[model samples]
Target: MRTFDTDALECLAAIVEEGGFERAAVRLSVTQSAVSQRLRALEAQVGTVLLVRSRPVKPTSAGRLLIKHAMQMRLLRADLETDLQDLTPGAGALREEDRISIAINADSIATWALPALGPLVSEGLPLEIITDDQDFTHEWLREGQVLGCVTTLKQALRGCKVMPLGAMHYVAVASPAYAAENCPKGLTTHNFRQIPFIAFNRKDDLQTEFVSRACGLRRVALIQRFVPSVEGQVRAVLSGWGASVLPTLQVQSRLDSGELVNLAPDVTLPVNLYWHCWNLDSVVIDRLTAALTTAATQALKVPG
Candidate 1:
C-alpha cells in the first residue's frame, strides 16, 4: 500500500494557501528550516519536486495532484474528528473549527447562495467561499482548491459527481429614463453602437452575449464604465449609468414597480448551473450538498 507523511503533505497545502513558505511556517507554528526540511523529505520520498520554490511558490502539475490529495485528506480528517468528538460524551469543542472551502460565482454569492448558506454558517461550520464566474468555477473544483463548486460545468470530473441546480435567468434591462433617452429608437442592430452598458469586469461578457443572442447583434460598442459588483451594476442601471443584462431575481421587483424597464421583455437568458463535488463517503459533504440542493430548488428556475 502506498503510504504518505501526512504532516509533510499538510505543510505543502499550507504553502499553497498561505502563498509563501514564511507564512506557511507561521501558520504551522514551525521554524522555517523545519518547514523546509519537511518539504525536502516529502519530495525525496515521492522522488518529485512538489513546489516550484518561486517568489510566492507555485505547484507544478505533479504538485497540484499532490496538493489535491492533501486537501481531500484534510476534509476527511475533519469529518473523522467531528464524528469522534460526537461519540465522546463530554468532549469540548475543537480549539479551531474545521472549514470547507467552496467555489461559487459572484452572481450566485450576491444573490441566493449566501442567504441559503447562512443557517449552516451560523451553526459554526466555517465556510470559505471562492467567488468566480459560474462558467469558470469548475477549474477550481478540478484543482481540488475547493471541496465543491456551483458552476455551469454540467459534466462530472473523473472523481466527482455533478448535480444540476437549475438555471439563473437573465433579462436585458435599463432604467426607464435611460431607455427613453439613449434607446429612443429602442434596442436595435442599427443603434447597437450608440447604447451604453456596464461590464462587471473584463471577463464579464454577460452584456455582450445578451446583445448577440437576443438582438442578433454580434459586434457591439462598449460605451460605458465598469461596475464590478451585483449591487453596483443594479445601482448603475437605476441611476441611469447604462443598460445591462441582469439576473431576473435582482430586477423582477424593479421591473414591476417601473424602477427598471425590461428592454427585451420577451427575451431571457438562462444559464444552467450545476453542483460538482468529490465522490466520497462524507457526511459533511452530503449535508452541504443537501442544503445547497434545497436552496437551489427555491432560488433557481426548475427544469421542465
Candidate 2:
C-alpha cells in the first residue's frame, strides 16, 4: 500500500493550481526548492510522474487521481474542523467554508441548478461550476474532475451515490418572423428543410433529435448556427437567426408574451436528471443535497 504524505500532497495540489513550482511556493509560503523536493517525494512514493512540468503545469493521469483524493480528504478535514468548532460554545471566530466543484449540463445550469445552488453560494460555500453535456457528466466523475455532477446517466460510479433530481422538458420554439418565413404552420419534414437552427454547440443534439422524431428522419436541417453558450443560443433564436429547442421553463415568459412561438404544440421532450456525488459523510454535502432536492422538486417533474 502506498502511504501518502499530507504535506507532499498539498504541495502537488498547489503546484497544479498555481501552474508552476515558483508560484506554488508563493502560495504555500515555502521556498521554490522545497516545493520541488516535496513533489519529488510524492512522485517517488507513487512511483510515477504526477505532473507535466510546463509553462502552465498540467496533471498527468496519475496526478489527477491523487489531486482528487487530496481534495476529498481536505473537504473531510474541513468538515471535521467545523464539527469540532460547533461542539465548543464560544469559538474564536467564524470558519471559512471549503470550496467544491460540480459538473452539470449547460441547460440545467442555466435553468434550475444554479438557482438551486444559490442559497449555499450566499452562505459562503464557494462552488466551482463546470458545464458539460448531461450525457457526458458521468465521465467527469470517473476522471475525478468534479466532486459531484448533475447527469442523465442512471447508474452511479463505484464510489458515488445517485439521486434523481427530476425531468427537464424541452419545446421547439422560434421567433415569429422566422416561423412565418419557414415553419409558418407546424413542424413538418417538407417545411423544415430550408429552415436554419441555433444549436448550443456541436455537442447539442436536442434540436437534431427533435427534428428527427418530428420529421420522421434522422437528418438535421442544412443551415446551422452553433452558438456555444446557453444565453447566446437563446439570443440567436430570438434574433430570428433560426429555430431551436429550448427548455420550456426558460422560455415561459417569452412564449406567453408572443416573443417566441411554439412551433409544435403537442411536441415535448423530457430528459430525466440525476445528482451524483461522492459517497462521503459530510455535513455541507448533505445540506447541499437537501437544498437541491427541495428546489428540483418544486421546478421539475418528479417520478411516479
* Model 2 lDDT per residue over 174-282, tens place: 9998888877787787777677878887777888888787777867755677887878877988898888888998898999999999998888888899988889898
Model 1 TM-score, 2 decimals:
0.88
Model 2, poorest ten-residue lDDT window?
89-98
The whole-model lDDT of each prediction reads 0.82, 0.81
Candidate 2 clash figure, as a count? 0
Give candidates' CA RMSD values in order: 2.5, 3.0
Regions of candidate 1 where Cα sits further than 4 Å from its true position: 31-33, 54-56, 85-98, 217-225
Per-residue CA lDDT of model 1 for 1-304, tens digit only, reads 6677888887887888789989889988899898899999988988889888888888878778888888787787667756776797445442232357889988888778888888867655667898888878889888877889999887899799989998899998898889998886567776756777877777787778888777776576557668878889999889987898889988899899999988887688888889999999997788789988889999999754
lDDT of 1: 0.82
